[model samples]
Target chain A: MSVDTASAATTRAIVTDAAGSSSRARRGGQRHPATSFAGIALRTPYWVLTAGLALIFLYPLIWTAISSVSPLAGTNQVDGWGFGNYATLANYQAGI
Target chain B: MTATLHPPASSPAPPEARGARRPARRRRGRRTHGALAGWLYAAPTALFVLLLFVLPLLLVLQMSGSDWPLLSGNQGPNFPENYQVAVSNRFFMDSVIFTLKYTVLTTVILLALSLGLAMLVQESSRWKGLLRTSILIPSALGLASASLLFYVIYSPIAGPFADLMASWGFTFLGTPDGALWSTIFLIVWRYAGFYMLLMLVGLQGIPDDVYEAARIDGASRWQTFRDVTLPLLRPTLALTTVLCVTGSLLAFEQFYILTKGGPDNSTITIVQLIYSVAFQGPNDLGVAGALSVIVLLALVVINIAQIRAFGKKAED
Candidate 1:
């Protein structure tokens, strides 16, 4: 019973400490709410732009990956997907 | 008993005094030993550099002054004649011009794209890791491998976008303009990430308080970037610019694999010209050696100029 009571008291202390810290953080945050909002507003567009550019930069690799598996790759006609292109590597002395 | 038997002048020193004196002497000896060991450890690398680099450089210089043939041996010192022949070659002159043009274009595009990407990645809040990794993935690919991949992409028949591009009436690697742009695009794709990493290091080195101060002063984004970021990033920019310029000047592999100096040798670089001269038919190894010497001298001069320019700016 004493051990249980001790653990319960510690948990209460932790909860109160967390609440106290959060309240302090909230007070600090409220002091410059407008600046924080403006900062986010300024950064949002750049974040979107970053994501778009990343996609563009990665497009070639993505295309290469998809083409490696597609049956139409290196051929004029598009067809069902197969591993024939990869399997053909076994025929070459260099082994790809 | 010994202390009592011996006179004052002949008596041995006390144990504590001897102990202190011994350590001082041992420490001095150890310092010398440590320095010797350090040099010993560095000797192999120094010897390797001397044998591989210095020896070859001297040999090349000697060969440049002689009429070194492809099939036979050197025919004694020819001196300025080999250099004169290299200078007089129209094809060599054309290759040099093309290399300079390519270097300027590649350096400008790579630096701009890398700086822009670095800034974007640095400012990003949520997807910074993902964006950086995706952009940097291409840099992990070997240059030759990337060139081969791009070769397939630039193909008229085998490319994934072949039909789509054909419908648009545009060929990527068929003509001179198309080929040059395609090669530039490939290089930018391959190296932008690597350079971006350099610029990002420069960016992250900047303290947050600097930006905070700029913000407090109500500086616009462009103003802050110009006044603060660019000045601070000068050293990194200098390094990347020099690397890009030198690498572009010596470009050969991509052009060799993709175009073979194609659409009329328009894309041939200085190194490619040297390779052809030394190895190809009508092989002139002496002229090639001279050309190599000229190139090495030019590179050294350019690097020195760049370093001096950056060093001056850093002092100011």
Candidate 2:
């Protein structure tokens, strides 16, 4: 039993001990946020540009839905009432 | 050694076999970079589909279900009534018949003529490219623009076609049958090259070695084509047929602007009827919405049936 325990200890040491000391030293000298900031700074322009473009292309459908269902029907009139224009479809069935 | 009897080796394990592991690490790093770049390139297209296509389609579907008017508030919760009216309308029936007829006739004639043209041009070494390009030029013209072009082409007084037919002492677009034929011919002229392009692609994909082998085996030209080329071309043939049928079924602009569904509304398509009923004639938005939904469902069913039929036929 003593031999078995000793061998098990040796195996664990081999598996876990290689990078433990080096990793601790590295962590002491540097921080996680610093590395994360470097990564963010390197990749920010791409992410920001993509997010901006997504908003621009998404505006039309948002506007259409809001107008279609909102009671703010301006000169366009499609927006004057909520769901009225959509309801009129029930009465007009020549093509349906 | 027994499983539990083996002792730990004192020697280092060949420096952890560094040779194979290093290249694997390097490859993993390179793969990560490639994946990031691919995502960066594809992000814009993904955003476009998400924001523009998917969202709008959902919004339209919602709108189609409600009693939403342009200038007034939602009066009541009405569902399925719009679809019911659209399905029951006589005008819908007329348009559906017209559209289906146009699709069937155009798709059949277009496939036959285009294949013949491709065969003719394939045999010709000189002017082949030019002929193909010239034939394809008509398709590049916008459909609305093509409609105007054909309008002038079919004009009774000054049109080249009328003059050509005058020599034969006949009118081109005067009678119902005459107008329909002219429309079909115009569509064929405009689209045959496009189908020819697809057929040519299929034809070119066939290996020269296969043809040579068949010839050396004493197979006749017709036999080689029948047994080899046609089988290889089944996929392209099915694709082009589907495209032609769908486009024909959606026929609107030419019939609407040129004929105005004239000759007693013979050329009037379902879409045109939907447009007239919803906007032009009685402003019956209900019926229009209903009709639109039915047509949309019908289109889906037709596409499914077409693919299944093709698959079954191929299996046979």
Candidate 3:
């Protein structure tokens, strides 16, 4: 375990060494951010775009959650909000 | 992938010591136990590959030649007959064409989109963690589970979007195009973050001095990405490309759960056809094994071509 940790740490040190801290040194040296993706200012548009992408990724699972409980017309749905799908899945193949 | 991330093991001297003269060759020789330790560490993975992959591969080869059935023992050898059957199977051509189309589309879209996402998340901004986390969380879901989840979500009668889809006069999986795009969307949503993480690693592995020089030279962001980032990321691209192509070719769980090769069997991938042949109507393991061997061979060829293409690009 110690050998594994030592090797992993050594590799990380090598990575950090190879990558260098020039960007951090530059950032500390001056305040001259511009339009590069890595060097860009953390403006409102950046946050908005990233958040929007996050929503697109997360919305489907959220919708699945909502529809999982909310009643529907043709599924093995109960009369009201319930775990009908979960129940059906639990009973499938002896619920595995 | 692992090789690119680490300093090449063959380089005995550290980068800084390469130009120094301090008996580096003899005095700085490797410890004797290092090789033994490396082998000891690698033993488990080697054992696993030998057991799981090599053993199954040999079995599949044998099964491909013999008249093996799913439920019973194998009969006598049939040699080339199973290969003929596999090639002439009813859905063989259609499934191959569909799988190829899916592979191309998925590879292009996923690679481009993941590159963009990686670029976005690689920024030293506050939202980086949130975006990366959310995007990658879906990858944690098992592919089968994600397929089932999308299956319910794509259900025409019970889905959340059913009403909107009804109003729009279109269903998610009612047609070939719709089914393809919808499944692609699910796949993109699930895998984009994972691939982005990979690309991000590659991006971060690039030395900051190189980008600093680019910026100092007044190189445009686009120019820097094209000349610096793209070239440096070739190995990662090759790895991801081979992986995406292989996974997309062997795609069965998603279609099996979401579409069930349905709405006219337009989405029946090659692996699904293999499964149906072995377990479904035909119940022929020999043919299935032959198909598997063919797919394996194709994968080896495709991966070699991709890696060689990337290698030539690197040399140039």
Candidate 4:
């Protein structure tokens, strides 16, 4: 009986603490309302510029990787999907 | 016995003591934070070098021992076969000799040109800044782009460079002997500015007072330059020469784009030959990896020898 009562009392205290903490958080957020929008409103342009430049610089490397594995490397075939192109390197030492 | 910690109330720790403790505690907090920040700042660079540079190098060294291609998954152990194959190859021998010859020639030319440019620009003239800027512009061009530029410049049918050479009763880059000189000229023009900057830094470090005293003592321009300038510039000269030699030894892009190892393969560098063996002709990356290891070992030995030679000069 004592154990049951103690457990119920502990649960009540936890609920009360959580409710109080959340109320405090909401009040704090309301106090400095501009802080909430500061990140998105101030930093959006920089984020966009960085993303654009990253894409521009990375395009060539992406193209090279795609070209290295492209199926159009062979005589007639336009599309290749498997590792056949990589296998052709085995016939590399046929001559000097 | 269960011990519970508690502060004594009889003679309380002083308020100033508590205040002092706050700063100590703050210092402890800052030390941990600062150490963490240092690690955080260095982590990206460390991880990048570890992953991209170090790992690939180790992988290449491992690949050099085995007869493995780019796609080799699992192969029987024929350890050291690649090394043997590369060692026995006559082309590898020729490429090494060619590379050494080119390195020596290019280093000599680059050092001379850079030193001359440095001397010219070191004068306290009004056009010094303009001259420096003009000289350095060539260095800003990418090696591959510069090679393409030279390819047109060296072409006989379409180049005024060829006409200018012919007017002087000589060809520049049309033949093998001419092509070697032409390539060296291109390299000297490209790198002279960068080395000039290094030389300029060394020249600036010489005290104005020393030059004043030398002038006051009626020292001639030649004597002042020969005695004071050269001795002080020894370290810089040695460093620049090594850089020029190493960079020239690793020559690839300029030759590949300009000469394509032409005129009976007289201009073929070690790296160009390695590229031909690995990718262009045979696609034998195993032999290429072995050759890379050999080249790396050779560079290490050369660097050590160079340091020993110039280090003695510095001591003197």
- Leading candidate by DockQ: 3
Q: Please give, for residues B50-156, the per-residue lDDT of candidate 3 as tens digits.
A: 99999999999998999988888699799999999999988899999999999999999999999999987776644677778889989999988988888878877
DockQ of each: 0.15, 0.01, 0.18, 0.01
Q: How close is chain B to the truth by TM-score, in each candidate? A: 0.89, 0.80, 0.85, 0.84
CAPRI grade, predicted model 2: incorrect
Sequence-dependent TM-score of model 3: 0.76
- Sorted by TM-score, highest first, which candidate order results? 1, 3, 4, 2
**What ranges in model 1 sit over 4 Å off?**
A1-48, A73-79, A94-96, B1-32, B123-126
- Over B21-51, each residue of candidate 1 has an lDDT whose tens digit, in order, gives 8999999999999999999999999999999
Better-scoring candidate (DockQ), 1 or 4? 1
Report lDDT (Cα) of residue B115, candidate 4: 86
lDDT of 2 by residue, B1-316 (tens): 6575445574445766767778999999999999999999999999999999888766556655767554463455477766776667777777788788888889899998787667655644334455665567666767777666667657776454557777777775666667677788778766777898898888878776566556545678699889878887888888988888878877888777568787777787888888887778756655566666677788889889888888887998
Candidate 1 residues A1-96, lDDT tens each?
999999999867765655665455434333335458876786678668877878867987888887877767354224787666666655656844
Model 4 lDDT, residue B209, Cα? 56
Candidate 3 per-residue C-alpha lDDT over A12-42 given as tens digits, one digit per residue, 9 for 90 to 100: 7755643455456433422345565555555
Error of 3 at B293 (Å): 0.5
Q: Interface RMSD in Å per candidate, to 1 decimal?
A: 9.8, 26.4, 7.1, 27.2
